[model samples]
Target: MTNNMKHIQFNNVSYEQWKEEAIKALKGKPFETLFTPTTDGITLEPLYTQQTVIEKLGDQLEKQISTIRSLKATKDFSSAQQIFGETAEQFFKNIEDSLERGNQILTIDSRVLFDWDETNISRLASILENNPFKLVLQDKNDVILTVFEQIEPSSRKQVSGYILSKEPIKIDNYPNVRTISANTLPYHYEGANVVQELALSLALAAKFANNENNFAEFVNKFYVNFAVDTQFFSEIAKLRAFKILWKAFTKAYNAESNIAVPIVAETSLRSFSKLDEYVNLLRAGNEALSALIGGADVFTVHPHDVLVKPTDKSIRIARNVILVLKEESHAASVLDPSGGSYFIECLTAEYVEKAWSLFLEIEDAGGIDAYEESGKLQRILEEVTTARLKSIEARKHSLIGTNIYANPEDDFNVETNPLFVDVKRLSTPFEELRLLYKNLQPKISILTYGKLKNFKPRADFVSGYFATAGIVANQSGEIDSIADLLNWINKTDSQYIVFVATDEDTKTILPSILENKRKELIIDVAGRFKEEEKEWVEKGLNGFVFAGQNLVEKLNAIAERLKGEQQ
Candidate 1:
């Protein structure tokens, strides 16, 4: 609980004072109503203040007279995995620290080998049954497991571990903690269905919630985790609705549990781009803030370079980003910054209604298993995904540093295993848009084929090799036999052509293209000796390839100089 939750915390500003303040703030600017609508028909306003915010909280507090329940951490049970070995103690320490460091949920990677044996299962069962760390299990089995059989009650009658079940939930994880983890890991991957994911979450939970026999056992213990990506606010509203709807249903059940179902949010680093690694910090920060304000009980800080082998620096940066937001910005200081605004409230209401309606619709379709069988879940997710991608195409969502603020002049090399980034328009003032591409070298098209990789261009581009010049590619069609390639280059009224041959045809072809005096030509072949190939590179090419350098960037820099952007 935060002190801001107390009465008189907002300074109790009345509507009149707030409006007066707004008027003064807007005095210099011409005030045209800039309220806009989102794709979902949710309205967004330019500004928000306490006047518009405080009342919503008051009203909700007044009407919903239930104690605001919260989750607490027991011992860091997530640390003590039943597996003991040389590194087990080290893993245990890391787990404890992460839990105490405020990682509220203890999650298991579903892909691990620990699930392979009965011995491992027993070890897991013991840890889950006794310890706390808000046990989250990876449900990898195609069929969901029933709780009554796998997890028996301990003395306090507590059961822990997510019970993946195709049937209704047994809720037998009580006395300690139990949840479903309602897997949405797929959502982070492109092509995963959003509507299907949300539907599955609801349907799966409902399977347990709707069952009268074990309804108390299941609904009381089950919780879900969601993969939150760059589409910040939608995920926020979606999560909030889940709570209210689930709360509404559970309230009807009249169960004995006091804690609300936990929402463990993992920020999607999948969207970050490795081309601009530093930029990912901004991406991670906003997503973290949104998840926190959206009220996730447990949140994760995924490293920006996670797509690559996660480096220590990236992980440290990722975790520190969260710490800065929470401690420095006091982001979580407000219970729900967007909670009461007419716009956010309206959006939240819309989500609650739409999602709940979807839930009911799923129930009508028999349930999750039936929906999966009918391909209904697949179709729904595809629909949501199409709509989401369309939003990107329409430029409703701006991808800064990509489409919006790309700097063609930056001496950047694309890195392998790129980082994920979510692009949004920042509220900061940018310097005048300098067209960096204007001074870069004209794109050099590489026409190559065969066992020789098209690495010099395509790989160069991906590795952030091109710094000052353009490399256009359709390498599959660029080069075939050297003779034909040379004829094509000769026909070019264009200034230069690089016909690098990768196959046996290069033996016969390389000579013909170089022999043509009509155009400037360069060959980049390694291992096999060719006098003309070396001669052309020396005469026609401007840069060196001696040291495994990313020639794209070097050549681009040369071109940039030729174009007179930089001395």
Candidate 2:
């Protein structure tokens, strides 16, 4: 369409030439520093060029990018979600409103035992007469299935849901109902990584696919559920990989090509933070965005405060996240918004390959049920879970408003146990530390001495670090005199005093401030002075807190000290 641009001439830079330029730009830093490796053993390069794509995927590079799809444009791309209520009447009303508010597929959690006198079931059956729906039969004993059984065979044609077990459920009468489901949430909540999650899903699908009686219809009737998190590119690649891997799994069964399985993506409760609850909004939004872009048939964004204190507004915001992404962002209109990108394409391939390997391993171990029963699945999940927790504590991974950039004055007034499911959360440790702060209101005084340049930066750092642990930081403006600083500390009645001045200023004023200090008050320095640390500790210095410090460990030690003092 545009020939004028083709006439433009420029020297094509070789990969080695570009690398030389990049190394020069890096100055003294090692070129290897640009690579980041994920737990799946995929090393990410700083830049992905055409040469890199060709080298990695070979002749498939061009075909891969063009074929990479986040989602297929199927059935007008309506946003689907599950609605739960206390009563059948209330749930009936919710269904009506949820559909009106742009929710295309409305799923009912099958645990709720409705007023099964046929009145409520009749009403739901009447609605299913026209619109499509899903029943989440997470538990085999969920009494709602009784009402479902009552539905006429014709009305059941439009309904779909999982049997929620390894063993297949086949109703002799309602043959149209989908009983086989790829249940991935159990492993997801147990902190399975992206690869493990995908592999587990595939393993479960293969189990159903291996069913001799239902082998032919399993791929068509099967539904997959997954927990989506806020790891932007990884989550996007995860969803896309699911489709790719699923197709490959089905291909072995001689199923139709490009058969897109119905995928339900729910935002991860483990990703929600209780400290700065507002930040959960961002986490949910990112998780929801990843699912929508990755091509999930149905998406559920859990309320930001769902783990602790979910309000009506929070629930509304959670549901509306999908709406906004679909309508406002117009993300639903694109088939694969993240496709064709060198980074995403490469990552997707890596994930698919790794996940396929794990699936094969699971298959070797006699499928998911046998592997899970062997306790190896639990051990592997625990390993990944531990690694993820360590990453958060070490600040290698960041959780805004929980582990980093916390708002000191934020209030966490929710009950210890909310009237909702007690989901496993990654922020539990940080939340416990903040709870101590809320209860004790421990005061930390910053003794800012020397010039503004010497102490201001460290003072701010100290203040923010304590805020993350919900500790109150009372920082005095630059006080050059040791007596003045001690006087301010006495007035504030701080139990912890941190010197925010320079190393030189701290060394000069150390003896004077240490003299006749409060016996119970813990003293600390803002920076590491290894040579002087032992001597300072001998002279009653508590510890050092600075950049790159293990803040969770440091704060936990402080909290323990405070607790002992209180006792």
Candidate 3:
């Protein structure tokens, strides 16, 4: 083989050319509608070019690119999976098993410390002496921190790990352990957008640093944790932006700007649902990849059933997601995989700029602590949470097995952790609705009229819509006349009946069926009849089910009606 490469020449298309083609493909839909606005107040364009990147970064484009590219010294990340067990022995066994299967860090939850005996503490100390660990402390109580005291000073010196806690911890001999954590997971769980998360995390770090007399020591022992969601490129950009923001933040304090801040990223549970739990696996995979490409120092994958009791299989699968990405895909072999892409670079820049501004705002408000104390943070979180829940309720945002495309037959009998009761998850409303319908066991029927072609689509829509709430609607055989519809409705025990047919057929037959049908049956129509809505209501139509309507609201009304009938 010669020391040469084959090259193929192709026509270089301008951004305008691409835009023109995209416009043509849009087929008269307003091209501006392609612009998507994120909750972070950033508008996402459909396409990004080198010119766009240049415009965003201005004179600092090359510097920004270089900074991001150099942010990670290595792409390798430790798999820091939490070991869950009800008892100390089981927890140790799980830790051993997880380590053997490629879990690099011994992740311990503080709650598990309550079950530890002297022997278990000894065993933990032994493990810590030889391995890296991550301890998640819910508070600064001495009881949980006492676990470190039991370890011999010599052994403790060999221990290397980080603690996830809001307060700073000082272990007598653990020199390699990082104590303070600036975590964005809480805000993320409360529905904070990417910019808010980044800014809040920085504000948290600033608070920690300001409280300490030694800024350098605080910087050395401080690490940040992020709950990576499934927004793929945006999430990758968010992480990258944090590094740039951290550099700027450190420079303001005259600290070393090049110092690397350790990032521990885990897949977010905000989008996880208990209904179609398996879909959570795909979500975790996507988030894990984002964390990998975005240069996290430690990555954790919460098991698909983490909301409930996680089985051994689910935990193993979660661990193997990282293993597969590393060993099979060789993603760890390259640093900054998203470094040069125009879109990612621009996005990273945008995040850095916006997040820095927000961080400054938070700092002016006396940091994260003062902001939280003032209740402003809680109010902001509430607003964002409401907006996000509304999106999920309206079906504007889709959670595969929770809000849209739900499995009506899926059983949700498993007990959930009480700890997650306060977690603001996107799927909670739909899950509650499903559970309500499952308990009610309402008898619903889809009363179809007209030919199969005309009625089947509407019938299917009504059935699927009800199925989302876990109500299986019985579809009646074709009814050609109003008398037949009335006979079926009267004979059946269904408390709710939905009329499904062509608009004209429904208009022709609905009046007669409503006039003759039993008074107790709550009748609704499948399609929207805007002009005739008031007329239909007066004629005894309960409601209408159509695309883009708020499914949660509609289902809640039906559920309320079911409750009223039961009473």
Per-candidate TM-score against the hidden true structure:
0.55, 0.90, 0.95
Candidate 2 has its poorest 10 consecutive residues by lDDT at 70-79
Model 2 lDDT tens row, 1-567: 677986899998887898899999999899999998775557888888776766777886555555445225253445556665667777788788777777766666555645555677667767755666666654566555566666777666665443444455656555445577787887887889899999999988887777746556665567788888878889989888887787778778876556666777788888787677888899888888888777777777767776654555776677788888888988787777787777888888889899999999999999988999999999999998888888887667888898888887777755643323556678788877787778877767887897898788888889888888777687788787888877876676777788888888888877666775777888888898898889888888898988877778888898788777777
Residue pairs with clashing backbones, model 3: none
Between 1 and 3, whose lDDT is larger?
A: 3
* Candidate order, TM-score descending: 3, 2, 1
Q: Model 3 residue 213 lDDT?
A: 93
Q: Please, what are the lDDT tens digits per residue for candidate 1 over residues 1-567? A: 566655654467765675567767886654444466554435566655544544445466323223222332221111111111124344345455554554434444323322335544444455445544433333334221332345554443664444332332334325445544465555335344334455557766766566546765564466676766666776666565566566656665675554466676667644555434456667777777777766666666667655445554565566666666667766466544555445455455556566667667878888866866898767765665565455443334554554234444443332333223222212111111112333343444444544445435433432222221223322335444545665666655433333444335545555555466453333343323444446645544333332234332444444554455233
lDDT of 3 by residue, 306-395 (tens): 998888999999999999998877777877788878999999989998889988888889878888899989888888888878878888
| Cα error of candidate 2 at position 59, Å | 1.6
Error of 3 at 551 (Å): 1.2
Cα deviation at 52, candidate 1, in Å, is 8.9
Ten-residue stretch with the least lDDT total in model 3:
1-10
Q: Could you tell which candidate, 1 or 2, scores higher by TM-score?
A: 2
Q: Which parts of model 1 are misplaced by more than 4 Å? A: 1-105, 110-174, 184-200, 251-259, 329-338, 393-395, 407-567
Alpha-carbon error at 560 in model 2, in Å? 1.6
Ranking the candidates on lDDT from highest down gives 3, 2, 1
TM-score comparison, 1 vs 3, better candidate: 3
